[model samples]
Target: MAKADMEQFIKSQLLKADLIEIDRQLSVTGINDMTSMLLLKQAFITVSNLVDFEITIRSIYREHEKLSSEYKSSSKNYEFAKYLRNKYIGHIKQELIQKSIEWKPELRYSLKRIDEPGMMFIFNLFILETAINTYVNDDGSHKIFESETDLKYPPDLKRFLIYLSSTVRSAISYLSNLANAFGERVEMLDASEQKIEHWIAAGETRFEFIKK
Candidate 1:
């Protein structure tokens, strides 16, 4: 293969690797609300992974400084993925920590739990009761709960997880299609490349094969 063909093949392989990563992340399953804390943490991780996938896809277009019409059409999905990442998973928590420190000036921010109102109340009640018992016993290292099933997940959380799973699947499909289209364009360019002899015969060898 010619040097130019080798370059195009490498570019296509790199883009395919990106697509495979996106697919692998999206293929992550078994994220459900078995426990409140576990569910919240998993949800955060899922959104973060989706955001990374979007960034990978964006990098391909940004490298060339041009966006395909298909990618342009799915701009809303990309924006929403970014919003979920920056607002909920990434920046908002940092902002909350900063605000807490500014307001108290001596207290540290700690995320103990995230759950619906009813579920939070139940967990708080359990903790309060357990603390009382442990205080009477004077055991500082006692376990909080014997089993994971001790904490029940809220209905609202279950519904939200379902919605989030659907959203992630939709985003993956949209982004995968865009990546595949990009691969197709790359393949077309590689197929359209002329041999050095042919280019010389046509007096077009002066043109460079610009790899983007």
Candidate 2:
């Protein structure tokens, strides 16, 4: 590989690495802002974050087999990130999802059982103890609850955001360090004299963005 190309590859990866954090923060905000009025909007934020998160990570490995292998070695989250990207933030494997997609209806007391027996009177009551829109999308990918074991969260989209953030948030610094290290190895070049051809796309390239 050309030194310039390697340099650019690393540089590009570093840029994407920064994006992963931005995506995480934005998704967190969405989760925090979730409400009945903003359900779809908030859900979209999470889904959007996941798609971008996966894309940024995937781009790091593109065209550069050697570096990608090294990059992948640093994080156990790579394959899982790809799986999320493949689903485009909507689809998770239906079978896996189906297995994990069980919700126990909140045990309700008849205003009398609130203190009877071993019933713990949990003072917090969700007024909007409502539905779970856990349906398969057109692409057949499952979402939300297929991830972590916390199914009591209710909202499918919010659940997905929490799960995705959990997986990707921990790796932000790890991937960024890899990119920064590679960037350090790349020789500084005059941008005006830089040849476009000198930069390789690195790995399997995808030009198509995921359809919403």
Candidate 3:
């Protein structure tokens, strides 16, 4: 493979991984800015970002010869990530449920008002837990839903994403070094800064198969 193509494809996946990290951080910040209705709308894309991250890393692992055996794809954290991707993005919840009796699907989230001088709302997730999860305040606070309720949103999501983000950053660095093996440096250092026109202006073309 050519140096430019290797750098481009690998970096592309790394970007997706990095973006998922940024988006999740912003999601916490989002709760402060988002209204109840807006929360519902933004939630899907936020969760979907993890799904995108999964596909990116998997692609780099499978398609790239260098990373194929180097990265192990086995982990509960990784599986949970793919499970969410499958449930929400794939839309095969019923199929999964019907296929296995143990696979029960539930969703939960925590939302509460924080009236500290200025009115504000705090949002958190408690997804995929078997037992009803609760977020309690020492003082009684107004809540839209019961404090202790069967919540489905995975609370561990934020933590899981932290693992993912760090992993991807490592992968990006690892991928960059692969360029040295090709006897070339990553020429397109400012890929994020450039628009599609920049690549077109340069000579990067889409990868096409040449069957033997």
Candidate 1 worst ten-residue window by lDDT: 128-137
TM-score of each: 0.35, 0.36, 0.35
Worst 10 residues of 3 by lDDT: 126-135
Whichever of 2 and 3 has more lDDT, that candidate is 2
Question: What is the lDDT, from 0 to 100, of the residue 205 in candidate 3?
Answer: 64
Which portions of model 3 show Cα errors greater than 4 Å? 1-70, 73-76, 90-212
lDDT of 1 by residue, 44-93 (tens): 45444544544545645654444445445545444444454454434544
Which sections of candidate 2 miss by over 4 Å? 1-18, 32-148, 154-166, 191-212
Could you tell me which residue pairs clash in candidate 1?
Answer: none
lDDT of 2 by residue, 1-212 (tens): 34654655565465455547456466545434223224323333433443444455454454445545544453444444444334323443454333322332344333456566433212111211112223335765444334323323467445555645554554454445545545655666786886655565534465888897
**For candidate 3, lDDT tens digit of each residue in 1-212?**
45455655555555445545545565465333335324332334333443344354554444456544433332333344344445533453554334222333221111233334223222222222211121123664312223433232445434434544554444444444333333332444564685877668678766779994
Q: What lDDT score belongs to each candidate, Candidate 1 first?
A: 0.43, 0.43, 0.40
Report how far off residue 27 is in candidate 3 (Å).
Answer: 9.2
Candidates 2 and 3 compared: the better one by TM-score is 2
Q: Rank the candidates by lDDT, best first.
A: 2, 1, 3
